[model samples]
Target chain A: MPRSSTYEAVLDASLFTPAQLQPTAVGRLAFQAGTRWMRDHVCSHRTLVHEHRVGFVLWSWQLEYVHPLRFPDADDAVVEVTARIRGPRASQLEVEMTLEGPAGVAVRTRAASVPLRLSGDEALSGVPRPLPDALVAAFHDDEIERTAHRSQVRALRAGFERDGEQLAAAVSEFRVHRHHCEVADQWYWAETLGFAAGAREELVLKYGKAVPGLRRAQAEPIRRVDVTWLRAGQLWDLLQVRTTAHRLGEGLAFVHELGLADDEDGGPYAVVVERI
Target chain B: MIVKVRGVLLRFTDYENEIEVGGNTVRAGLAALTERYPNLGKVLLDRTGEVRPTHLIALNGERLTRSELDREATDDDRVDIVTAVSGG
Candidate 1:
């Protein structure tokens, strides 16, 4: 009755590590599955914006791995993904996703997103907007369950840099390359970090300086990553990625803020939070 | 005399979505479009009065580079503005 969608795919050999195991592959796959679900159910033919000025922004996401996914060279892992909308608020939407394999549940993800209205100048405002009636009715007709963690629905704020002081002094620079901005398969934003050449190296160099033990921690696996798109960059634009690292309980946390190289106060193009 | 709007460019046109211009080249067509919609110019062109680096202009399905904006166009030709959008 409700619009619960399922996606099926096989874990290719290329997705496996040298040990025949997939690390963080489940998370990446689950993210793709969620985007696919949104494209199919929420914004099928219409754009994400309702009245040209109002739209949705991904606020936060959390993925928990229940079991490691292993793709042996002899046998490929069959992956099944199911995603559904859980809570529909005046200005927020909650989604739950489950990833399963032969070993049963491999990962579960919960994501919270916010609806924003553009001001007269066509810039996103902090104020929330009402969800489109059509979208609301779609969820109601499906009888999607109410999210139990609605209490988690807090106003989305820029991470780490709630104040400018936190991000000062840590800067990494990059240039938007053609490969990163190429549109393929109707998806333009291909790379999560927004396609700069040597992105990994730039990130490592910046983060390595901010965090003392980052080089040593490379051997450890990343536990989680959250990305927020504040703005968009075009080709040939010089961008600077500013990073700040904090020491969490047992791991290192990083906040990377991306913006035009010439204008730091103009605002960020995107922000990435990674835990390793 | 027509400039086609595609992808996210439609958002800036208020969805009335059509523009009439008088110019034999892609540059002239965009200049006319921006004259009518100043906001569109802000999004489509950069401070240097050049097409924004992220946006691509195509004449009859043939993409033109920033320098090629001066390429010839006739009233019968179809000029489209293209920009890559995030799937989120």
Candidate 2:
């Protein structure tokens, strides 16, 4: 079953004027993945405006796992489309698309064709019909639940941020004890702390690592790092562990650091991280 | 001369500090320290016998930030091992 539904409509490039296509929250997120990717190669923001072309062509958006975004995007971006759909806009499209990313393999998505009806003033008369009320009702329910969950997250995060001082105060007292040798050299830094991994490969998966490394650099050694647990909950706050490697002739030498604040709001806490 | 890097120190979570090995120049000292404290060696080094990115090395009271450590250590050098770190 599809975890969610997203409707995409492509208009003839000439039919919709530039100013008229004010990106919608749905539209913005629908194409964010492509646009954000384009940002990497773009030299100027104006080019972003000039090259607003995204998966606008129906046939180019084919991928098993390139799904729409989970959050609402405020702006639109474009990225590498299929080679089949390159070059200037043609009179019509002749391609297929597939996308699935935000969620796992539990969802299905379908795209339907929508013809264009241009008026004298360059208006789009034909629009995608809204989903049925019953069908929409389920989506509404899903949206409600998702919104509620997000709202709770936002509320808790806001509360946490508000109490950052207090939380930091409370956080000072605990240290994370990383039991995994794969993690650190120490048996115990803080009697209490939260443990999270910070590897380059993992970091690259989440947020692409710095470009130079991905494109050409050889594999750098992993840094030794751990954190001090500050707060406890579904969400965790901690200090940082950093590792760096140096090469001496054919051998390698490594250095690492744990960053922690000893005091916050006049409270005492074991630095999940110690300042270098 | 062996250097020991530590992991993070927290209040609630479990585990202890890290004792990382460094200074290609001080391999013997680090090996001895690891022998004295087996737990430290196991936690800091990876499958490749290198320090895991999740921990840090501290020399005495000072934290190590040399992008590349001078693996060569003098016989008199003494370093402390600490924990992996977290937070902003």
Candidate 3:
């Protein structure tokens, strides 16, 4: 049988909004659940990375909301999270995860990650490497669904290219500070979600009256989020988040491109699409 | 001049979204603001009393570079103090 793992955590106010869990919080917790699953099912991540000189980098991630996930106002509202490995390939793998409340699953996440060769200094080498056979063997045979990763970002970009009309757009400029960094002084990947939200809010604040269409995003919940990271941003690096609003079905979608504020030729470090 | 406080920094400003302070430059206005809200002073400035680089400034809807903090401003100018989103 394929292995699955469960994690239990007490909810805090910081993790919740009035209607649901904060998207960033969901991303953080979902990643944690997937990591715990990997540690339980395979060798420990520390040993795999430190001893085997292998590291996993997120290539793409998608989250879909099933319900308005909420927790009661209490000191100890515990939520259950479960994750299962899926689509394990030679150099890439995917994890299917769910966050469950009392009623049922509220959010589903599928993230694709690629293994990298850590350099001698423990720096991310950006070089793809094959997964250790023993580690891949730890996964259930049926869970080894070898398939190419489909990027939601590419599809959305293609759609936007065809449409070619932006309802609204704005750019938010800021510097990556120590607070945004990891041990290597590189901005943590999950912080992109927060930057996207801030950029969206700034857009609404600046042009909500001029372009009322963007208000739909301000009032509604994000139904889905797709993210792709192209590179890492280091501390004190000035960056810009370029956000554009678009019509999606009966709702709205926002595309955020984060890149160097001054380096136009460098292109975006990350692209995030949020569907409301 | 009025300095608009945003996001988590609002808690440090007595929940005041907009605050009026006296100054002719961005630095002077910030100085007055910090004097009024001592708690915010600690968070908004570094040991050198310069604005933290993590926070961005917009004067009258135009982005301002760190060197432009000393640029002249009028009493009618609106300064927006936005905390750059970062991981904790």
Candidate 4:
């Protein structure tokens, strides 16, 4: 068993709130049960298909049977949900919704909503595009994002492909830092971006202000970039990234497969980064 | 216009917002536009007079392969950018 698992966050509604009791999008997108229920309903639409780039979050929800859907006297139904945030912007919101029904009985249940907001560099603040799945039946976290990456359904798609010891290295990297975002961020900067104290110095000597993270490349290419508010429940935040170097003529192209984390049962929650 | 380049660490704002870097000719104008955004000098042009990955170049009022814009810039051109970056 992988030492890092995100099982605790998916199964329990103890951290959920009551304000998310609406049937609207803010409620739906932020609640796991609502997200799942909504996806099941949206996918059946003949022309509707969801797409994702790098910033997408996923959710988990439980269906507590309510008589509202059955009888002629039921008033409402209850929903229970759990969610996991993916990417840099991470946070989980467990909530309950009262779905009005044909009967007078109000079925109240708990739900969870995972939000992956665009939180970083305060300069860039905006709502996320959209969650790829409304009701996720069965899809690997990487596969969920891959569904969009493999196919050019979205405007931006980054393919970071890696195999052999490299892929194994990434898997192990995630396992080691399974429970800690800080560790994962540090290692990613060290191993991936190669951030060092003087990293930007070299870039400054070369491109001056032309480069963003212009610092001394003491030992790494990555600068002090950090990840925040990530929520995978108890599921280990396993990012299945793929790295590849396709010649862009004289230039080079690097790809990454940033998959979201999942519970032991394997329900992917997000696609962190498919950046090139 | 200072637009966002997804993978790129930074951006270069000059000329028009749409696209003017793809036309078989845009070196002079692109260089001239650089005067307005001096911060982009090191990125848009190398000491040997070449475009660097520091900034993604597009033309023809559309988004095409980088090679299409990799050629020498003339007086006028076209270039469109969705968001280009080189990140690991």
User: Which candidate has the highest TM-score of all?
Assistant: 3
Docking category of candidate 2: incorrect
> What would the per-residue lDDT of candidate 3 be over residues A75-140, giving only the tens digit for each residue?
332334433334435666777788777666777888877776554232222345667776777767
Determine the backbone clash count of candidate 3.
0
Candidate 1: tens digits of C-alpha lDDT, residues B63-87 = 8888888988888888877563332
Worst 10-residue lDDT window, candidate 1 chain A: A151-160
For residues A1-276, could you state the per-residue lDDT of candidate 2 as single tens digits?
223223333333331222222112222333333333223322122242233211121211111222233223213222222111112222221122223332422112121111122111101111112222332233222222211000122332333334332101111112333342112122222222122113222323433343333211124321111222222111122344332323333332222223343313423222222111
Q: Which regions of candidate 4 are displaced past 4 Å?
A: A1-54, A57-79, A84-276, B1-57, B61-68, B73-76, B84-88
Note the B-chain TM-score for every model: 0.88, 0.48, 0.93, 0.46
TM-score-wise, the better of 2 and 3 is 3
What is the alpha-carbon interface RMSD for each candidate?
Answer: 8.9, 24.4, 12.3, 13.0
| Residue A203, model 1: Cα distance from true site in angstroms | 5.6
Question: Docking quality tier of candidate 4?
Answer: incorrect
Runs in model 2 deviating more than 4 A are A1-276, B1-24, B58-88
As for candidate 1, its clashing pairs are: A2-A142
The candidate maximizing lDDT is 3
Give per-residue CA lDDT, model 3, range B4-59, as digits (tens).
87544655777787899888898899999999988888767768787766567889
Q: Which residue pairs in candidate 3 have backbone atoms (N, alpha carbon, C) closer than 3 angstroms, thus clashing?
A: none
In the order shown, the candidates' DockQ scores are 0.06, 0.02, 0.02, 0.01
